[model samples]
Target: MAETTNDTATLDCLIAGGGYVGLSVAVAVKHAAPHMNVLVVDAAPEDALSTDERASAIAAAASRMLGQLGLWEDMLKEAQPINEMIVTDSRTTDPVRPVFLTFGDVNEESNEPFAHMVPNKVLVGALRGKAKEVGVTILHGETVDDFITSDPTSEITLGSGKKLRTRLLIAADGVRSSLRDKAGIRTVHWDYDQMGLVTTVSHERPHHGRAEEHFLPGGPFATLPLPDKDGKHRSSLVWTEPTANAKRLMEAGDFTFELELESRFGHKLGEISVAGPRKAFPLGLTLARDFIRHRFALVGDAAHGIHPIAGQGLNLGFKDAAALAQTIVEADRLGLDIGMETVLERYQLWRRFDTVQMGLVTDMLNRLFSNDITPLRMVRSFGLGLVDRMPGIKKMFIDQAAGRAGTNPALLNGEAI
Candidate 1:
């Protein structure tokens, strides 16, 4: 573990959980206000990024934010732009999966693809490099065990018994945030009774930057395109199923699991083979009751955990980072305490409506599509067809998904905060 002796100096911000969101916050703040002292403490080992095999869909807005942080040029080398998206609704055993909705280079004027699929390692490494270059300290294999928010600062105690002081503490510790609970922040949470199974798959034919989402009775089985390797086509698959079924598939022998996967994945990609380890994560919706308290604030999954039906989880977290960083940078420039409730409230107010709307949309989509009820299926199929037929409406939906709708922070607009 990286160790720092107990210090009397107070930092501008101390962020917990050095995942993408936390790291982005550190880098964003430092990029905006170079004089601020920012530190990121995470419980994972220093080499954790090297072992992360997952891939995240980076929205257009997030891609812009990465560019502003000077990481996009390097990330683009490993990023696969999502040039097209097809949505289909059908049963797992259906003979044909008909596409009901489609988005293809939907925003031609901007020339920006709706999103990109980048390996987790590539993005994290870039963010870590930027953070290091900007003098943001990152302490690995350490966690904040306790903290007390008082007058002008918050005192944090690490698991190793070392203590530090900071003007504000940001919790990016994920869905089950310890710091959030410690700060007496309550959440509205409920399980979706579903699990998302993720893995990489290599196929005979290329995906051609086309992503597909098959809305099955169990849940949405998403096939997101990824860059190829050694002449082999590749894609990331997120297969959602009931908790029991997901466990069964995970424990199934490779051959057996592949057989089941082929049924849902179809033969369009040609012969497919699993490329990496398969992992399953529970699906749920968790929203923190309040985004800030005293000198503490929550960001990323620490603030909201929504259904992944829309693949907007990481994007939402990035929005939080951008909003919070902008709020702090602006407050500091005004010679005001960055941690004050007034400053924090602006961040909360900026993000709350969007967060709530996304939560409800995902929840409704999951419930409406994750079942085989005949009447409901007909209704949803009609809804999908209706949306597909309306060009203007479809464009609006595509723009919204690209994170171009509503008020955006300067960072999200590819501007320095």
Candidate 2:
């Protein structure tokens, strides 16, 4: 609906933001149709390395998609598989002790792990490399100065004074997506009174590749395993706490802070030491009411950003990348405008429910655990116990983790994405 500068040449798709979402979308399209001229315009400096320390969880569904794309093999060397998940309400120190709940596998599912941990850098590296192999062009250090599309083409003007034209334009920029805002797409967003403190830690014992989620009073404290540097098991941590508490933790000396962390994370890992610098991101949800307009479409965080309590943020983006790819691929086969309204609407419909549903679940998890309310805590913990005991109910969650429970795009199911 918004106007973009007209460039003489157009691309099949012009993706803004070089993060996981943008790179993924580009790679997915190129993988399906190498002839489609896809280009990614990113503002990150050219010197930016591929192995960023920030870690993320790739859900089982997303993993299967990568397997289809031939990226799983490349990512496997670096990814740490999560075979089991242990969840506990750590806020209450009652002798009855908070229940420990573990999510296992279902029949014919190979008892495979729920997800895997991939550092942001490695995943992007694999994607960028695969994209080039598939003939997708990437322009780093180029910022999107402006963008607009009329009828037959969508044009983009970069900060470097370069231009490109594409049949379709995708905004995978992220929660603060300029392209989405520029398109006059309204976003419904709200930040919780919390921040997630992310870092790595060294442990004395082996993690057994089990991911742990502690429902602390402030929020969720997630400890996911990683390879050790010197024969010791290490783990990445995303500890959500009140904003003030996070600020204090950030400022505190490492020795003093690890003491606090150790108290909560000690048992499983034995003695733990901070292995990496702490990074903080405020927790929030962002939902774009409209995912498509005219010749444009939004994907990844640009479309919807939900709570990371379930570690589904990046996986959700992968879902978008995969679905958008399939939609465009099918349109190309049908000889329709890649940016046509009908095709773009298909992507919107497929991803909207998944995004909205995950948003609601994560939002509820965040709210339900962020307080010291006695009754709520009792009910929540009991509910966890109830689900753990019920084979059918627990299987529902396992199926969801396996990307089989809900109506999802074919790509996430490892078909095409």
Candidate 3:
């Protein structure tokens, strides 16, 4: 029930949901095609983006993309390089956990670490600043209530009664995207019956930029490095467990919670204590059936939501932003209709397979590790051990984690569209 208005000037691209993915799209598009008029709308208040305490792993290729957009320098100050990573498989109460696989500190050719850990606020704030500096119109505390797509243009109505006309409408509104739903885009979705417990921990010993992932009976438990806060060594922990157990842990007393954490985390980092408030997020896999429909396209979690066992969720979203921006900018530069079916189809073809592959891999990893079946556990452990014994296989995995194994778009490779 949108009030159609042709009086308003038409936008080149109208993006819904101004999170990291949405803002990155705005920055990438405007930076590439300065003449294109772009507008970003978010349902949350202006300060909401900077309020998140979570941190994420940024693969090297994604770091390059941020650098190209002039964000990496500012974010670099707060980023913690992940110099090494180790993987182990063990039961929750095991007195000793032996590492079955490990990745070294640097890429063979460039000597660059494969990834870095950065606080969510630092990255979001940097993108937001860049978006505004490039003249991308931002409508905070506003939501796209409805939109109608026609041959030449799409008209969107906001919650505040403002109407906008745009040639393309991009939905980056997360997994349960309202704009995506309104466009009649269907998704293949399912719950993992698990939840991820996230919080920071301060330790007596330095992590030295090393990350560890332990495959436990419940799920994968990761301890990712973070820059020390207030002179204390810190690490961000992603602990996955059964949904019921996750809830119980969240509600448990601090002492009880610490004991359970100590059992999985071990004593490698010396004494450890939870440094902040703990939060739990339900796990799931969701992939949209179609990435593009008419003048509307999906990006980020709106298009796909995968299990986070591989820590590639944010990186995948960044890939979507880069690819979509490149597709749109190239089409506009060629004097073609950017929202045409052919133009959008190219983007769908470029990204869909990689997204599906990652989704399947993460889903399989979660399934393979989140249990205690003796035979299956033995098989996976043997596989891990075999991979560790082969340097070539280890290098391949490091490259994959660095995001260098795929068919990447120019923007992701740090080039202009």
Candidate 4:
């Protein structure tokens, strides 16, 4: 349990939203700078994260960061490493889906899987425990209703009418972030008219750590391997469809839903059954024009939210946490004010270009593959095949997927800040 805060005492940092990104920020800052006081205010109930059935793919770089933070060892027990990935382009009714591309291990030397599929509950639980262990206070069922930025501090008002002041205010509240809006951060946004249907399935046979992405006329259907439970083989599914179609599928009976699912899933893994509740999340591209102002900073979905076509949404958020933590810790070590605009600008500059580039890439890929135009299909297929045949190009893609391609911060490289 977290200790109660004193309204009159200013904190080194106050974080909004206790999800993965927010918790990561708190833990990283407190772990490296033990003298800095950190507090996290989460709007959800205390048990909300324990019930999340969804899962996310943690890239190699992210796993390394977790290991450095002393949380990956426990998470690795439940995580399923993705040894291979195959891509296919076909219609839902197609009996045979030809593989257009395939990726093996990240590289020859490392022989390490590029990513791991981790349950959301497990990840959140681990982060929460670490945050507590590092002496960071977390206030559940509380929210930052409003904030006033001053020269050296931001005075935050909670929903319950309590007030606190912090030298730095970070928002990791998610894509539809109220805090971002309150900060007057404008975004370049658009709806894809699509929704991603997420669920888990049990199959007759094991997935052997193989992940598949099938590009149908509607959208991409991704089947990612999961660790077995009670001797049963299971996999996580992310099936994308048009808004109306997604709602219809979700509303359908189990039998009807399975029938439609089989059309896209096929019998590659033999008999299958939905093993978890199904949920649909609307898809869109949201990129904040500015990531910082005064004593405020935006991380994770508050800064940018992109299509899940590449399974990079959460990984991108991890990158933001790493960069921002590095910036903050270094500033504090140098006797500089961590929340000043000049100090926060370094974080914004480091992440903005990468965020924009990824958003554009995912947008282009989603647009190119979500339709069945013969000409566009031919071009995309040719491009996939060409890249597959080029080992060098394929390796580059693998590196990018592993989150090791660019100018990364120290934490991303598994180093301490």
**Roughly what TM-score does model 3 have, to 2 decimal places?**
0.97
Highest lDDT model number: 4
Comparing 1 and 3 on lDDT, the stronger one: 1
TM-score of each: 0.98, 0.94, 0.97, 0.99
lDDT (0 to 1) per candidate: 0.92, 0.80, 0.90, 0.93
Candidate 1 lDDT over 186-288, as tens digits, reads: 9899998899999999999989999999999999999999998778899999999999999999999999999999999999979999998999999999999
Residue 297 deviation, candidate 1, in Å? 0.7
Please give, for residues 136-208, the per-residue lDDT of candidate 2 as tens digits.
7777777887777777886777886767677888887788888888889998899887888889888888988
lDDT-based ranking:
4, 1, 3, 2
Between prediction 1 and prediction 2, the one with superior TM-score is 1
Tens-digit per-residue lDDT, 190-277, candidate 4: 9999999999999999999999999999999999999998889999999999999999999999999999998899998999999999
- Comparing 2 and 4 by lDDT, which wins? 4
The Cα error of candidate 4 at residue 408, in Å, is 0.9
